[model samples]
Target: MRHLLLSTAALLAAALPVLAQEAATALPETIVTATRVPTALERVPASITIITRQQIEERGHATLAEALSAVPGLRLAPSGGPGQQASVFLRGNSSRSVLVLLDGVPLNDPSEANGAFNFGNDLLFDVERIEVLRGPASSLYGSAAVGGVVNLVTRRAASRPFAPYGELAGGTQGTVRGGLGATGTIGAFDYLASANGLRTDGFNATARRFRNTLNERDGLQAGALALRLGWTPMEGTRVEGTLRYRQNRFDLDSVPRDDPNSTGDDRRLMGQLRAETRLLDGLWTTGFRVAFTQDRRAYVNLPDARSTASTRDHYRGERLGFDWGNTLRLPGLGFATDGALNFGVTHAREEVFSLAGNTPFQTRVNAAQDSTAGHIALQYRLWNRMDVTAGLRHDAVGSFTGATTWRAGVVYHVPELGARLRASGGSGFNAPSLFQRFGTIGTAFRGNPNLRPERSLGYELGGELDLPLFGRPDFATLGATWFQSRVRDLIIFQGTSVANVDRANLQGVELTLAVRPAPWLSAELGWTITDATDARTRRPLPRRPEHVISATARLTPLPGLVIAPQLQFTGRSPEGPFASYRDDGTSFTTERRNKTGTLFNITASYVVREGITAFVEGRNLGNSRWEPVNGFQTPGRSLLVGTRFGF
Candidate 1:
């Protein structure tokens, strides 16, 4: 790992002379997650990554986890096969520290252990883009933003009167997928709607040596739907609404019984209504939004093939949220110009219910909580060459003392040098979840009502250089960031109850380079070095690799054709306390070191005509048997072929 890091540094040093001779250009695209406003990527004082729809298609990424794994400073840990539980860790932070949003609305399940968003079932259907903002962002997004935020933007109505699209695909493991969508604008109204379905006869989720290995495949089936509508009744005023729903069913391995008849179902529904208007000649922009979401999950277990009845467990969670916000273009102060102020108030209520059925330890539980928050932010351009942003927020959770968070950042650009320097610092917190506070399931687990919210303080500094190469219009970008965070009251499961019993400190460095030597070719390289430890025990955090790297190259060898190859490397790390169930009905914990592994994937796509395209993708070409989690097994090489058509 050290040698690899040195090699990467040397590569950057070798390119400096060529970069110094180049001219500056505009940033790649605009992003909204950094400040809740559309701003140029180079001007945002944060470590961020933007994945567009084209990128998604080019890579043939089917899940959010696949798409996000390539981003710098992010780690993904999948427990088993498709539809199984998965976790996303950013900068060595806990999965619960990262907040996920669908179309700007929070998607975390309040009934989950720590209010984490499970990416296992989050498909890419109708997703237009993804924006990942790294580091603490609670000053703007409130709870669960201790690590960062991942915002998914769905497809919107097209500018033309009407447009239709569809796709069909099939692959190994008896996989089949299909999707269709339409978008259009008509007079004062615009609308977009899409639907997708997928099914696969997946491989066994556990290793052959595991006691639960039934030698039976764990299959999955899923369906999703989305609809978005907008109306412009008058000038500078718009009303918009969105609806999304998804359902999935998958087979699982019962650890104790080693039965193949365990199955699980998950369903999610979301809706939002928003109104925005520009008053006072566009100087003041205001909006109000109301949103609701429901997440339901159920599991059934059949002890034997001849069993006529089954044991079941169910959980349901719902949230209702309201927000009103406005952004005002303020007059300049002294030498500063283009000043703006943003303020918003938010209120949300969450409820959860759980049932453990038909057993001696059966239990029924219900919990609810409400929160209100207010936030304000200010941005100003100073000296015509620097941008500064600051924000503060206060939240009052039910029956808990108020918590306050704040953030400030600066971006300084030297146009002539084609360089920029950025820095930011913030405080963040995660409120206890309903499941952790008041829910209980059978005799295996219990809740603690006195638990407190987890808190953190973090900061980052980075620099970017945009360089023109070879006297052509092609350019390259190189960036480096260093960050550190300290978290207090870290939550963990002790025996049968959850508690905040530890503290942690994490620090890391991320390096990224993107190059486009010509219109036909592009390449990217990203590397992350993390040092995460328990403040009390000084032990390395579990499942967090000290080094991670990813690289990709996209080549257009022929007209309307693209071939892309990608490589990902995860360095050796600690793994342990793995529970291994024995045939005697006993279980024990064991600790072991995980081996480093590398994966390779490739995709090729070609445009067949003006409105048609075809693609094929191959994943895990090396067929490595690496397990992200100690007891589970990962799939081997697989292939998929697909086609898309538009009208």
Candidate 2:
């Protein structure tokens, strides 16, 4: 695998120009997450993936897990179903180290043990696009960005007349899904509104290998609504407000056993307001943004065969944040000119109230934290062939010591060869969760008041090339990157307490290819090879898959029709908490690594009318019922049919 990655990298360096135009008229792809501003794809110095609405609809991606599962350097572990708790691991870092943003609003739950974002419950019907920027980005985004950042940009109000859309689908296991929305502009005011829901009577979530007797269906019901209003009084001057609400309930399955009565509910409300304008004839721009979010969680578990205990839990968490940003631009002013300089300051307050006992008045695990940070960055292009970027940031969280981070990147273009060479290095940090810093349990377990934030240093070297294959100019594209990172001050549980204990070292390589051998045939391939280990013990990190591969092919045999087939392969991983059972089949241990697996999926769509389309989706077509985490069962084969209307 290592040799293959190197060979692929070599091949990529000899391919076509990354910015070569298909016909000299195609516009370059622009992105915002990489540099906190709109920048051309070839001009950014980061490993980033942009999934547009067109791509999402073409592939029929419905959930965050399905959309991200194919990313080269990303891994998603869904506990059981679409609504179960799903953790994201980017480039071998912990899920807590990855920051998630919904339309510029932070979505990490402050009450979660690791302050991580739940990837399972989100419905993407209102999303316009998703931007995934890989590698350390604390220099720009602060905490929870030690691994990477994901920004889900919501759909915007169209500048044209009002346009309405709807979708409805039904499938196996008594599942149903639907969405409705409209976007348009009237005079100076523009508006967007959308509502979506999904429900499924899921399959039994007990691994057959674990001897499943209780085959109760684990299911989920989820719904969300999104609305936005904007006033574009003039060019370069705009004000906007957005509101979103999501609610979900999902059944849970016990590990190493089946629990028929365990279930959970989660709800979130989020709001944001922002205004921006250009000054000095577009040479300077300024913006202010503010957001508030609330998350509520409740769970109940009756006595199961695994334990003779019944429990009830609930948590409430809130976050409020404000930001002011400015950008100055000067083209051809100096050797390192033609780009913009950006500076920003942000402040956020997070509060959490959690009770895990049988009653609402149970013992408390409540706390709050505040973080204020400022950052400045410079991005320039030297003669339109070299792209350079640098940034520095400092964050002060509550009473803890300060954290400072910095990042630098450079991309050198070889336009004649259609190739670009890129390199970037950065430092990042993840602040301790509120529960880690202030929560306590009746004298037996005390929170670590002195716990420090986890810190990491990472770097990546990469290149991209245009594929001039088969006498076709820019017929395809290939890219490769080698990355490494070191994370220190990992938090670990010591039976009764938690402490910042070890360090981790991770290294990986990613190779990607996008090819269009024919007008009607297109495909993409991604492969990753990773090595993650404990800095001190040199043992493989838990749950880090060593090899992952994803492939997708799109076939369009006729106009207004598309058929796509996708596959994902995950390698064996090292898992923990080894358990042994006696001959009586009573009280077996739990938490172990799952076997490697490959899953199959396909989607077919056809336009029935000018503004209406019908589609069918097939997931887990092979019935691979594989597990990403031991004791957590994945769904089997299922089929769904739906229609989309737009007029």
Candidate 3:
């Protein structure tokens, strides 16, 4: 089997040569992130990828999970379809280490069962674009940003005129999806409203792998509504408010044995409001974001043991932030002084309730925490072709106290050298979640109030080259980055069959690149190598793989059309806990490693005519029989077709 896998990998590698005949174009302009401002992507000194709406539609992506499935160094674990509990991992980091943002609003539910929101069931119809920032972001985004950040930006009223658009798509896996949206300008006000729905009879979650006691078939139905009201009452001032609501019905299956029959449903809602004023050439902005989410589960058991047992988890969190940043042409410094000062506070409350017996296992846990932070950042154009930036931040979390993060970055552009050198270093911190504090599980586990926050010190160095052959325009940009980070007092779920686990330290590196040498073709490759281990034993972390890679190439045979081939690789990883399991089936015991897997996918799309287009996409084109988890084989192969028309 291993030999066959290797041979297939080789064959795929050999095919790339024939696929490289396409042409390339110059890099796209950067949209400012990290700071509440706009900046060129080339000036950020960080690794970021922006997945546009066109790409999402052309790829036949039904949800955010499907859209991100092909992004390098990103792992999306979907229990079923659009409405399932989805886990997102970046560079081998825990799902909790990644921060998600909706319309520049942080969507990480601090009150969530585990201090994170599942991205699997997140609907994506109203999103205009997605920006993925890789590496430590604590200096700007704090908390779960230790891994990276995903910001979903929504569409606004079209500048041209009021337009209405809609789409309908259905395919294998018992799926149906639809969306409707409208945007228009009314006097000095521009507004947009959109609503989308998706449903699917998803594949069986448990694939009879290993103990294979659970045989649960899952399904999902989700809907999202969004509204954006923009008030441009004046030229220098603009006020916008965005409201979004999402609901997901997810079925969760219990682990092997332990009565097996049980399921759960999850729901979430988020909102953001902001006001911006351009006073004296500086942009001043203030905003607040709020999120509420809940999870409910039911257990099925034998008639004799049929004591109605169930669990419900609820979370509520909010953030109030205000910032005043500005840009000034500094003649004395021989550069532009673009700077920003931001201050914000966050409050979160979490509660978990459960019923375990015929009567009720009524158990509830609650806590409220607050955090305050401030930051100042500056960007300078040292030369016509070079730019440098420096920033510092300070955050205070109740009980956890003061933590500071700072970074210095420089970008040197040499049109003649065909080189762009970029580098940045900073510090980051993740406060203990409410669950990690005063929370408690069943008779099996408990929380630790004495746990400390996790901290990390890291840096990244990389460069992009627009190489040229003779007098040609080069038409290609080659970029690569190498990064390393070390964390202290990492938070991890640790249990020795008796007590619950706490968070702990983690360390790792991420390497990524994008290259295009021709006008018709381009390729991107990314790999994440991590050593996320227990701070004490230094043993490898559970569920986190040591190596992961994603590669892809695009071919544009004609204008207004594109075809892309992609591959995703995940190295050997354990199927269950990393420790021994007792008779209760709960422990630190490690399950056998799930064999490495390489999946091939092809995506193609073309414009049919003005205001209309169609697309076709296929997954696992090789039809390889592989197991994402032991014994449980993934779908052999699947295909989806879709179309969209606008007026």
Candidate 4:
């Protein structure tokens, strides 16, 4: 795997000059996640990836996992099938260390194992774009950002009076999906509304390579609705609000047991209201936002098909958050003219409730916590060539000690060489989840209230170069980065209770290249090498692959036809004989290693008319039987066909 990645990097470097065209155009992509403000991508001083709506449509990506798999310095592990449990690891950090946001609202579930966001059932029907930041961002976002952040931006209203769109798709395994949406602007108000649904008969989630279960086929049924409204009351004043809801139900299989009468259901609701105004004749701007979210889950276990449920469990989680901020533009100081000051205050409250019945140990648990935070940031440009940014934040939790975080970054540009040098360093922390602090299920597992928050310090240095081909507007870009992080006070489980007992260190290098050789063709390649280990035991982290590579190419064969091929490679990595307890009450651990694996996918789309389009996709083309989990089976080959209409 190492040789393959190194060879691919060399090939991309050697082919850059030969593929250059005569275009010298600059790519001006605006991103807001890097610094909590809209900033040009080239000057952000951080590693970020933007997946646009056009790319999503062309690639036929239906879910967030599929769209994010092509990014560097990231890895995903799925239990099995669609709508199944999945975990994302960024830069070798724990799955719970990454923060997920929907239009600036946090989406983590307080009742989950570690308050992580499940991407399994998150569809992309009304999404406009996705931004992924690849490093710590605790200075801007409060907690759960020790690794990175993923922000999903929903589609906005169009300029026209009204526009409507719809799609229908079907595939193998009894799969069917559909969606409808409308967006438009009327007078001083703009609105967008959308709904989507999916149903599929999936394979058994616990099927293993050497053993097959007798359980019936697990299936999934899901639906979602989203609405957004905005009003422009005056020249510099605006009010906006959003509402989103989703529900999913799926069959389940008990680990190490063939249980066919088990099932689960999940539902989520989120809403936000925001207002913005400019003051002092456009010299200052201020904004305020409030958001609320709720998550509910239910599980049932039946001993027989004709018998009543043997056991049932219910869980609910809720969060309320408020934020207010202002930014002021300052006059030139010394050699810097583009100067600004930013400050913000935030407050959040979280609660979790759990109930169980028809079991040996029926129990109920309820917990809540609140936090308040304040932050300040500064930005300046020197000689119109160097950009600098710095920020500091302090948080006060209901019971824990106060925590503080800080970050600083710089970006320098060289016009003659068409290159930029950037570097950033920051501190991050993750507050303990409700489940870890107070949860208890029967007498099997217990939570400790004395657990401390996990903390980390990380830094990165990188550079980017843009090269024009044939003096035309076509160009190619190459970027490379080196990053390292050290974490302390890690939390883990001991016996039946959770505790802080581990520490870790992770370091990695990432290389990426994007080329548009001609108007009809474009390609991208990325490679990442990571070294993650336990700080105390000096052992490799479980499931942290040493090398990863991804590549994609899009071609326009005809006037309205597009074809794209994508490839992803995961290198051999270590797995665990995760700790487990037998029915007889004996505890033990297991160990193993996972083999290297690769996947290839292809998609094609054609515009049939002015407002109609058709598409087809093939996934897992090679029929690879690799397992992302230690004892689970991954899907083989599958195909889907779809059509879309716009008016």
Candidate 5:
């Protein structure tokens, strides 16, 4: 691994000079979080990757998971089928360690049965771009951001008069898909809307061992409708509302014999509304947003249990918030003050019921969380052509006990030294999930209500340098960053022993590089390696892999044509077949198994006419057989051909 690091560094050094001699577009120019004030990507202190709209269209990436997989250090844990359920991992951390946001709105739900949003069900038809920040973000984001953050920014009404577009795609395994989108301005209002549907005969979660391996192979069907309406009545005051609905149904076949014939059907519907006033007076911006979401899932198990053979789970939540922020430029002390003061109240409710014939063990739970947070950031330009930024934030989590969280950080730039330095330390926490509190059957095992909220205190030290002296042709932005974070009290499942089982600690690193030699070609590579062990026993984390690497390249050889090829490699990771088991009555441990796999995906597209295009994509071009989850195998070599037309 050390050698690979050195080799990559050497490669970058060798490629930079060659790229400098060629004509290349500057790195992407817009970002919202690095400065809390939209700034160019080149100025951000952390390692960030942006998947542009062009990449989305040219690569034939139809879903969020597929789009994210080509990125290094990021891995997708797919489940069931299209729009079913999938988890994203960053730098070796699980989905529980990553934070997901849609235009700054957190999608995770402690009220849900699984404790996290089912991302597989999220359709990407409306997404404009995706930004992935690789490393500790607790200083900026808060809890569950221990690994990183994936921010999905949706599209807005274009300035164009009026436009409507749609597509139809069909493929193997009974797969069929279609979508419709429209954007325009009418009078004083601007609006955008899109609806997409996908259906497929998903592969079996487990292979031949089970009786219904094919039975385990189920069907997947889901649809989503999202609309955004904005009214800019005046320059200073504007209002916008967004409504989205996602419906999904797929069979779940990973149930133990103690409870067989188990399957799940799930549905989610969500909406948000916001109003902002710039005040145009100095640098004051005030905004208010009200959001709501509801989720329902039903599961059916063995009819021979007792008498009742089915279970039902219903979960729902809503959030209300108001915020006021100000930016004050003070040249007097070389200080610029920008801060946001936010107040929000949220309500959550959940209920799970199990029935067998005449017997039923039903449970219902509810909770409310009110929070207030404030943060101030300062930027100073020193005499040595150096720029430094310092920031601090304080958050109060609840009204009952008032749990508080805080974060602080600073970034310094030293151009003469050819180095950019940044360091941040922060504390974040996540409340216990509803399923963790009230015993339930979402997992083959039972939940423990005694579970406690997870918390952590961690810090990171990182630096980046540009190697323009190296001689590679397509070396656009050649820089690398490394970061490490320590997390304590990580949430985990426990079936026995003290506190009836709970949480642990986690640690990890990430590396990325971008090379764009000429205007006609480009390539990006990334790698992430992690080590998460039981702080006490030093044993490996259950399913987290140790290594993940990816490479992507694109070529536009013709005026209206684009072709891309990608390679994804995941290093052997250790996992136990069962969470726990006893052998020969000795209770000895079962040796962990390590798996290593690779996959290739390709796409080709051409514009046959203005606003009209045809494309074809092949996934797992290598026809590689890989396992995303234990015993559950993924698809092998699949093809999708489609076309799009617009006015």
Candidate 6:
């Protein structure tokens, strides 16, 4: 591997400066899911990645796919371990093309069949950061944002009055977890609340060498709750409200038939109410939102023994949404310099219900859809170092036909040649799920109410540089990006209906580097290279994987202690374990190529002051059995110990 990336970039460039003080708390200088407002990340021309809650508490991240595993053009594809069933693929699209949110609701899964949204069973314990917006946002989030968008902001309020927090833990297949919270600022009322729970005794994704190992063991349970409130009645105006809930259950097996009576149960609830206002003096701003969501899932398989009659399934997806936005500050229609103008509108209504076989529940699905949208955008800054943006959107679902999307961007900077640049282009769409248009599974799988609604055209380009390494001066940084996309009617699953793949193409390349060089050192590295094809049978496009790498480091010698380490790499691609006696079972499948894996982890913490802390966590520490899909398998070496608190 190129001499292990040239000795891990010369050991993070010789540990970037040994040691020092003060430099964390800098990854979030402002970002609101890339362009829905609150910008600033160098004018945000797209391609973003932020995740900070003190780096998920110095890296012991639990869920949200382990805090988006290694970021940088994501590519998760779990099928086992840690509450199984996962999928996330950005640069290479498909995971129903990204889009997952909370704090703007919408968690995909309109009866699934590919509306996707599992990211391995969420749970970021009321996250306060996590805003990854990669590309194609459907001109401000309209239909599955097409390979990007993951919000999740929650957790705010705490500048005194009352602030509290907590967490507890235990580990290894008999684990236990916990959480509790409180936050405040009481004069004009500001608050936050939380609760969390977890349970485990897990380990079993079959694949005990596929030697038929299944002595039972596949467990997990979860719980969550949250609340938020705010008010400011006067001045620049503000009002807010939020609520969240979650429940989960797990234990399933059947990959190579490790069937111990499979199972799964899930639930989700969300709510929101918001209001904003700021006129004149603040350059005009307006906002309104009302949201609701509920998702329920169920699965069961008893009486196994190769299907001796016993099966069950159920799913429900619901939604009710509304939004209105505006922001204006146009410097009186003059040439540039911090000018802006943006406005948007949206509406929604969704419903989905489904049921399935073996005790007379026999294949069924009820569907409903209604959506509306409107958008407009523009931003400015010029002469002071370039920056521009533009947007447009139009959507109408339910009766099909009525879609339009657009996007534009620009950015530039050159402070004494430290350099920076960006570019963007867009269009996106995706619609056609409800079990791919009115589900009905008699012949096993069929539903194609005239399909059609999967379009795209994308672009991106980037650059960044900031020299001066060990001696200071912006202490090292480098970045690169390149992306491309093209698609039209690309939805597939043809064995008994469900089609569309007239064309397709996707491209990628991303590279990054960072080295804070002080304040107790920090390191980062990322790489990606993808190609996802199929433009007329060009093949290569199943679990998209053409190389990916990630590295991390954080050290804080002593003071209060901290240590973090991470690494990941994946290569070899192609996968399609079509299950069920293969084609004879009708889903028509074929593809193979899985071999390639590497993962390592580490975490350590200490801080017995300002609200206590103590921790240790290590996961998959090189137990490598490699199998992200084929036959499941992916669990090995675990350890955890925790503690956290705030006051």
Best by lDDT: 2
**lDDT accuracy of residue 101 in candidate 2:** 94
C-alpha local distance difference test of each model = 0.85, 0.86, 0.63, 0.84, 0.62, 0.80
Residue-by-residue lDDT tens digits, candidate 4, 545-598? 888899999999799899989998988777756523233323347655677889
lDDT of 4: 0.84
TM-score-superior candidate, 4 or 6? 4
Residue-level lDDT of model 3, residues 1-647, one tens digit each, is 22432343345334433333332335657575654457777767777788888777765666787778766557666443355456776765677878887765676765554566567767678887889887777777767787788998887688755888777777777777788899988888898998888777655554444353444456667788888888888886777777777776645443333233344455455555666565555455544444443334433333224335444444344444443334343333545444344445444443444334332223234666666666667666765777777767777776656778877778876655556677887777777777667565555556677666677777776666654443445544555555556666666667712122333444444445565566887777867655555556666655566667888778888987889888888777654554333324444555556667888888887788887777777877886656554433455466767777777
Candidate 6 residue lDDT tens string, 189-265: 88899998888877877666654465477888988889888988787898988888888899888666578777888
What does the lDDT read for residue 140 in candidate 1?
Answer: 91
Q: Please provide, for model 2 over 348-398, each residue's C-alpha lDDT reduced to its tens digit, 9 standing for 90 to 100.
A: 999999888643334457888899999999998997689999999999999
| Model 1 lDDT per residue over 1-647, tens place | 33554555456545544466555755458888988866778778888899998899898888888899899999888766678888988998999999999878999988776788888888896999999999999999999999999999998788888999889999998999889999999999999999998899987766555653566888899999999999999888999999999999999864433457889999999999999999999999999999999999999987686456678988898999999988898898888988888899999999998886676567556989899999999988898889899999999988865789999999998777677778999999999888788766577778888888899999987777787767654478888787889999988889988899999999878998889988899999999988888899888888889988999989998999999899999887676454444444355576555667788999999999998999998988898777665556666788889998877
Give each prediction's root-mean-square deviation over alpha carbons: 3.0, 2.8, 5.9, 3.6, 4.9, 24.6
Clashes of 2: 3
Q: Each model's TM-score?
A: 0.94, 0.95, 0.84, 0.93, 0.84, 0.33
Candidate 1 lDDT score at position 391: 95
Each model's total of backbone clashes: 0, 3, 26, 14, 15, 0
10 residues in a row with least lDDT, candidate 6: 17-26
Q: Top model by TM-score, which number?
A: 2
